[model samples]
Target: MTMPHKTIPESNHAKPVNLRIREDVRVLIDRAAKIRGKTRSDFMIDAAYRAAEDTLLDQTLVKVDAESYQQFLDILDRPPSGAGFERLMNAPKPWQG
Candidate 1:
């Protein structure tokens, strides 16, 4: 005889998060979440995740020689590339029609 396997739900892996926020802050978050059609928990999670990524990015340090730094500045001083910006500017505007 074989034993049946047990199935686990995704919620089992999730941990509860508690926040002690001001009533005004809670209302503001609820408004923003409603505009985006997401539950308050989902909106808060997305915001917290993005903030974490930004915090991580801020910790990164790039090392470059003096010559490389000047080259980077020189590139920044140049005008925008001629790939498609010019063409887009000259393109017809439907709003005017």
Candidate 2:
């Protein structure tokens, strides 16, 4: 059986960014890029983008135990307080002012 091939979507390349690195770091990056059959810029961009994504995701992701997870779900299931509806109904319209 032949395994299906996944395609990478085309990326937008309208913006450019410049970076400065030491010679030693540049040499190591070049070596790794060669081994991966990718250009130095492509390798650096992909690695940097992945690292940025991982950093942001690490910050935003939540981990909870089973009991805490159930409590969280229970909170979401609760009905909203009527105060919100009252505030909306009493608020002045911007267009009227």
Candidate 3:
């Protein structure tokens, strides 16, 4: 006798993902999750999903005409110097200290 098998809908199916992280890192993640009012798994998944999206988006290349390309190069060669740039350059270096 063959027993009937039940299938779950694709959307309702989830696979287990295991990770090994340091205790300190886990504590940090837990604190952030608590502040956000979400479980650690949800917070980690959201962060990982966003990072994957950003990685893909960063790899996108746009086709440009030669004249526009030269303009971009010019801008890069001589970035505008303003108060914002000065402030950023003069900011305290906590890491160095």
| Off by more than 4 A, model 3 | 1-10, 78-97
Better of 1 and 2 by TM-score: 1
RMSD per candidate (Å) reads 10.5, 17.0, 11.7
| lDDT against true structure, model 2 | 0.83
lDDT of 1 by residue, 1-97 (tens): 8686332334657889999999999999999999978789888887887788789999999999999999999999998869597888889999988
Model 2 residue 73 lDDT?
94
By TM-score, the candidates rank as 3, 1, 2
> Model 3: per-residue lDDT, tens digit, 1-97?
8686332234556788999999999999999999978789888877887788789999999999999999999999996699999999999999978
Q: Which lDDT tens digits does candidate 2 get at residues 30-67?
A: 99999978889888877877788779988996788999
lDDT per prediction? Answer: 0.85, 0.83, 0.85
Question: How much lDDT does candidate 3 score?
Answer: 0.85
Candidate 1 similarity to native, TM-score: 0.56
Return whichever of 2 and 3 wins on TM-score.
Answer: 3
Instruction: Show how many residue pairs clash in every candidate, following the order shown.
Output: 0, 0, 0
Span of 10 residues, lowest total lDDT, candidate 2 = 5-14
Question: Candidate 1 local accuracy as lDDT?
Answer: 0.85
